[model samples]
Target: MVPCEDYLVSMIDLPDDSLHIIFHKLESCTDRNAFGLTCWRWLQIQNLARGSLQFKCSHRSSISDNVRYLSRLLGRFQQLNSISLAGCTELPDSALTQLRSSGSNLRTLFLDCCFGITDNGLSLVFAGCPALVSVSLYRCNVTDVGLEILAKSCPTLERVNLSYCTLLSDHGIGALSRECLKLRAMTISYCRGITGTGFRGCSPTLAYLEADSCLLTPDGLLGAVSGGGLQYLNVSSLRCWAGGDGLASIGAGFAKNLCFLNLRLCRFVGNESVGTIAKGCPVLEEWNLALCHEVRVSGWEAIGSNCHNLKVLHVNRCRNLCDHGLRALQDGCHQLAVLYMHGCRRVTWVGLESFRMRRWGVKVRGEENVSVGPSLDQFFL
Candidate 1:
């Protein structure tokens, strides 16, 4: 009789294409690694199929050794298109220089909390990865010089996240906006040095922006919105009341396309600005005005009157939002679907029940302080 082992069909006997399909189907890293260990042929197929690689520093190993190991892996994965290195605190210029030899296919690079790499290292690495399209340097020690070099090197860049990169300023932003015409999405949240001036004549192709907590001025805000193509904007926690005009400018310039707007934590935003946005942004769908205590009846009425497309509205913690505001929203905002009013102390159960009676299909979510003392019904009456 033939040996029993002869009856077993080896997965290695499958065609290379079939093996590649199997490798792609394995979503977990652990499963992929196990698949590669099946045989040398399977390992080669796994390496060829892999396009993205991520590395995190091992606390048990020395930094230098980890970098050396990383360099070796980079060489082995010559087909890699995306590379992410997180918490590589002491990663040196020489470590990234290895990409110069094997990063011809690299298109995406993400470095988070990699404090040691600077402009020189960036210049060297970008020179090799000229086709890079998306680069995120969160909390990296990079400045305007580095950004300028990146802009010039990779003109095809589309998405960039420089959040928490404190060293960058408007000069770097200007260079990027001028050079990368195809740029679409950018996040500069917590970047205090960027006052929005860098976006003076930025590409109209740019649409999504997150500038929360930045030191934004009126002129800077105008520059950002002047492109007239912004679809999503987040300017939360902006303290400069003068920039309120800039917020209103979004409705003027991006009226045709702006869909999502977040003005959360803007404590000083008054009725005038809110009214302007409501009158102009007819297509505005989702708006977050949480923590905006100054917006009263007029602002809410304007929103209900003009923002017919408003679907999701967040007025959480708005101390001044009373029965009238709720009634106006229920009456005019016909498309209103989801309403969040958490911590709204002034809205009584009677007003809320009245709103629910009218807009029974709408989902209202909140924790109003109704039982603290005498109800706010007397004030509304």
Candidate 2:
């Protein structure tokens, strides 16, 4: 009889197409590694099949060795298109420099919380990687100088995330917006230095923008929204209020395509501006107005009547919300699927029960903080 090992290998061998399909089905890097080590056939399949690589560290460690290891792996995996180096707090600049020579076909690169990368290192990396399409430097040491270099180097760049990069001012962002015409998505949340003037006549293709917890005034935000292609916008916790008119301008410009809007913790925004948004953005699907104490039934009624496409509504911690508002929502917004109304003190069980009975299919989630305190009455039979 033939050797058992040889027979097993022959029997288990899969065609190239079948092996490729199996490799495509595998998502976990650990699984891919195990599959590759199974046999010589699988090793060859893994080499050809691998396209994206991610290095995520949940705990802090010296990633200098890991980066060197990645450089060596890049030689083996020539088809790599994306790489993520997130949570590697101790990663040095020199490691990124090595990546430039190895990652030639790289399209996407994420350097989240890699605090060690300064302007010099990033400049070197960007100089080598011209094919990069998406780049994220979330909480990195990258400054205006770094961004300016990136703008000049990477022309095909589209999506960029610069969240919590404290040193970057409008000068860097302005340069980037002007240089990278193909740029669309931007997440610059917690970037206090960025003023509205930086985004004047910026990318016409820009769709998603998030600048929450920034020092942007209503005028600054309004300028950014004027791009006329914004579909999703979040300017929550703005340093100052520019009144309802600023938001009204945004609504007018983006009414046709705007779908998701988050104005949570925007204490200064009142019913007037929100009402305007509701009327203008008729196709709105999701809205978050949490802690907006000023909004009453009038705003809810407007949203309910005009925003028929609205599916998810978050009015959590709105102490002013009452039965009238809930009833208004029931009258309109038939497509509503999820509702969050925690800390709606004025809403009694009777009103909630009635609304629940009306839209029995909608998932209503929240805990009522009845001033009457915890008692047997809290439970509705």
Candidate 3:
């Protein structure tokens, strides 16, 4: 057998393709870095094998370091697919311009909390990267013009998160719906300007939609999702305008396959609306009705008997909930694995304890102490 030094030398001389196969086996970033540091040959091979990179610019030193490293990687790796610059506060538009100049066929890009990325810089991104499939601009300064440019440029975009993009309005959303036919999941939470018109007459290819805290009226929702197979829907906090009638419309028309629904803080939602949901969504598995005070014991009874597939229920801060409601859930929802009832004033220790003692009881953290049962965080864990 050869000596240890000779074996080391032979390993370093392995073909580029073989080295790339070995790199794929290294799961952790630290392990890959260590392997790259073994020798110059391995480092070159490692760079070639790389497909994703994340840069966080916290301090001045990190910013400079990231710039230099990114420049080198962009020059070397043409196969880069994913890049995240989340929380890179100091990163300027110039850096983004440079990244786009690399002409990488980027599939996923996250610029969340990158405060420096303006419309001009983002315009450069959309213009340069047409192959982009997923893009997030959470808390960025991107406006309607940038969105318009994005819609016209990237036709293949599937997922987009414009959460907290306060400047974007219905015009931008309408453009996206009209142009990006392949778009699947969209998160427009806190974008108040987005009304139902954006989705009107557009294709119903969207499966996931999170439009929480928006101005989407019930009719607008009906018009927007008329044809799609929407599975996950979060229209929570619609100023209570989309009440039972609105929910009923959704259940009857758009969301037959709906599994997850979050109507948290929808103050207008009562037993009538929830009853509609029970009858409409037969496959519903998770429901979040936190702070929906109008839903009483009758709603719980309806859910228990009708929504048999529901495995997770969050009814926190529902002031009207009492012992009767808990009993309804206990009797009907046999598949329930998680239940949250914190801030439910009428549900006392006695009612909660009896359920915990039974075989069907979920036995979540707060089950041990009937009076002050578990907090909301415990159920989530």
- Candidate 1 collision pairs: none
lDDT of 3 at 80: 78
What's the lDDT for residue 309 in model 3? 88
- lDDT scores of the candidates, listed in order: 0.83, 0.78, 0.78
- Estimate the lDDT of model 2: 0.78
User: Which wins on lDDT, candidate 1 or candidate 2?
Assistant: 1
Clashing residue pairs found in predicted model 3 = 366-374
lDDT of 3 at 293: 88
User: Candidate 1: what lDDT?
Assistant: 0.83
Better of 1 and 2 by TM-score: 1
Q: Tens digit of lDDT per residue, candidate 3, span 269-358?
A: 888878988888888888888888888988889998998888878888789989898889888877888887677889899988877777
Q: After aligning candidate 2 to the native by TM-score, how far in Å is the CA of 148 from where it should be?
A: 2.1
lDDT of 1 by residue, 135-234 (tens): 8898998999999999998999988889999998999999999999998888898998888989988888787788878888877777887677676778
Best by TM-score: 1
Candidate 2 wrongly placed segments (more than 4 Å): 1-49, 56-70, 102-104, 242-246, 367-381
TM-score of 3: 0.81
RMSD of each: 7.5, 7.8, 5.3
Best by lDDT: 1
Candidate 3 residue 348 Cα shift, in angstroms, is: 4.7
